[model samples]
Target: MTVLDVTVPFSTQIREASQAQHTEAENSTFMSDLLSGRLGVSAFRRYTEQLWFVYRALEGVTDTLAGDPVAAPFLRPELFRTSALERDLDHLHEGADWRSALRPLPATETYAARVLEVANGWPGGYVAHHYTRYLGDLSGGQVIRGIAEKTWGFAHKGDGVRFYVFDGIANPAAFKREYRALLDAVPVDGPERLRIVDECRRAFALNTALFADLAEATR
Candidate 1:
């Protein structure tokens, strides 16, 4: 049983531990093409469609864990993205019913299922998934938003790109600092901390897998 050294801040531990996975996810083929403007609007729309399923599953467990000691500290309602995703889908679908024809790729199904599984049973694990997602959105996700807006000629932070726009967060950098503080203070033991770090890596791999699926399907 390897115990994580508590002398290091938990936030830094997880960040360092998951750095490789994070880099792999960022360098995924689909994302590289999308960000480089090689992929078309349909590709971006399809990617956003997949995000709706994943966010729905993630947010679905929020209410259940709202009062949980381990999960409650990370539950910021403003971080929720289902509504924003829906609006983006509305625009992507040109006002059609996205849900009626919605389907998750196999990887997305597995990813969303894992999110629900951990969220239902382990608050620490749930936070692992949460941190992997929202933090990345605040950070590298801005690049995607910028590329999408420029490539597709969408209005700035409107309609199609709303998912990357965090209207409630006035300062993303400060909010990320506060979020890392919450991770640093997550009230869990050494083994649990290690487990959470592993989960964060897994979350990134799952995300990368989803992108791989998109690449294959679009190819």
Candidate 2:
């Protein structure tokens, strides 16, 4: 009798496929400087500003994608960051008008556009972008929150770093596992799975480009 090897889980494949791009995004110079305290509060504020635009685009389609079979499984309200980001901006701006002053970097505009494009055109691609951002927030994003709080003297998980705080997620580890299970069960065949993986890579590349733009602006 011949033994058949089990197929690799989709979650695992997607992660492995995008590991290179993910590393590139994480190691971007701007993120390194910020995490190491080399950058100031101004830099952090700008980065958070960029996040607002991106999350707005990401969460904007909640209503449209709520009924989408491919996208609905991943549409957990607890994962929304736009409101938390607004609170952080309010604190960062010290009650001033951040809205009129808000301007996305050129790269950020492109990133937000791509997110909306995928959200409208491809639910699987929307999931790809969603996984990259929110999961990163749950995992590596905590480190950023800590560094910001300590460096900037913000209250613990308070206004400034609240974007990293998932008040609704009581157990991050369990939640992540459930999220990965959803990825594994996503109703896509092999070719579509490949496309999703490509979308994940694209998401990471867009993030890296944003960081690169930030590096230039901050330097």
Candidate 3:
């Protein structure tokens, strides 16, 4: 009898495929300065403004994707940060109507549009981008939140960084584990898996572009 070797999980493949883009994003001039407390609050606010565009686009489809078997399981109320983003915006841009506070950069517009594109079709592509953004936030985003608080002297769990505060997740570690399991279980053939992996990289590339654009503008 011949033995067949089990292949690596899709989650692992995604992580590997997107690793370069992920590193570029983290090491991008904007993220590096912001995370290191070298960037001013105005720049951070600008970053948040861009985030509003991208996340709003992503969450806008949550209701639509919520019924999807592959995407539904990943959608959690706690993971939703648009409300927190609103509060952070209110605090960050007090007195101004945050609604018209800032315009999306060119890269930000592209990123937001890509998210909307996948939301209506290509569940794999949708999942790929969703997993890329939210998971990235839940992971390294904590560091950025901390830097924001310490640099700007915002209260812990306070308005400025509230977007990073996940009130719904009691244990983020466990939630992450469960999320990865869900990633491992996404039903896809080899070609579809490759496509999703490609989308993940594309998502990260879009993010890096946003960062690069921000860095250029802020400088």
Best by lDDT, which number? Answer: 2
TM-scores for every predicted model? 0.98, 0.97, 0.95
Q: Candidate 3, residues 1-219: lDDT per residue as tens digits?
A: 212123877778789877998898889988888888888999999998899999899888988988888788878888998988989999998857879647899999999999999889877888998898888788898988888888999899898899999988998898888898898888767777778888998999999999999999898
Ranking by TM-score: 1, 2, 3
lDDT of each prediction vs. the true structure? 0.93, 0.94, 0.86
Tens digits of per-residue lDDT for model 1 on 25-65? 99999999999999999999999999999999989988899
lDDT-superior candidate, 1 or 2 = 2
Model 1 poorest ten-residue lDDT run = 1-10
Model 1, residue pairs in steric clash: none
What's every prediction's RMSD, in angstroms?
1.0, 3.2, 3.3
| lDDT for each residue of candidate 2 in 117-206, tens digit (9 for 90 to 100) | 999999999999999999999999999999999999999999999999999999999999999999999997777888888999999999
Ordering by lDDT? 2, 1, 3
lDDT of 1 at 8: 88
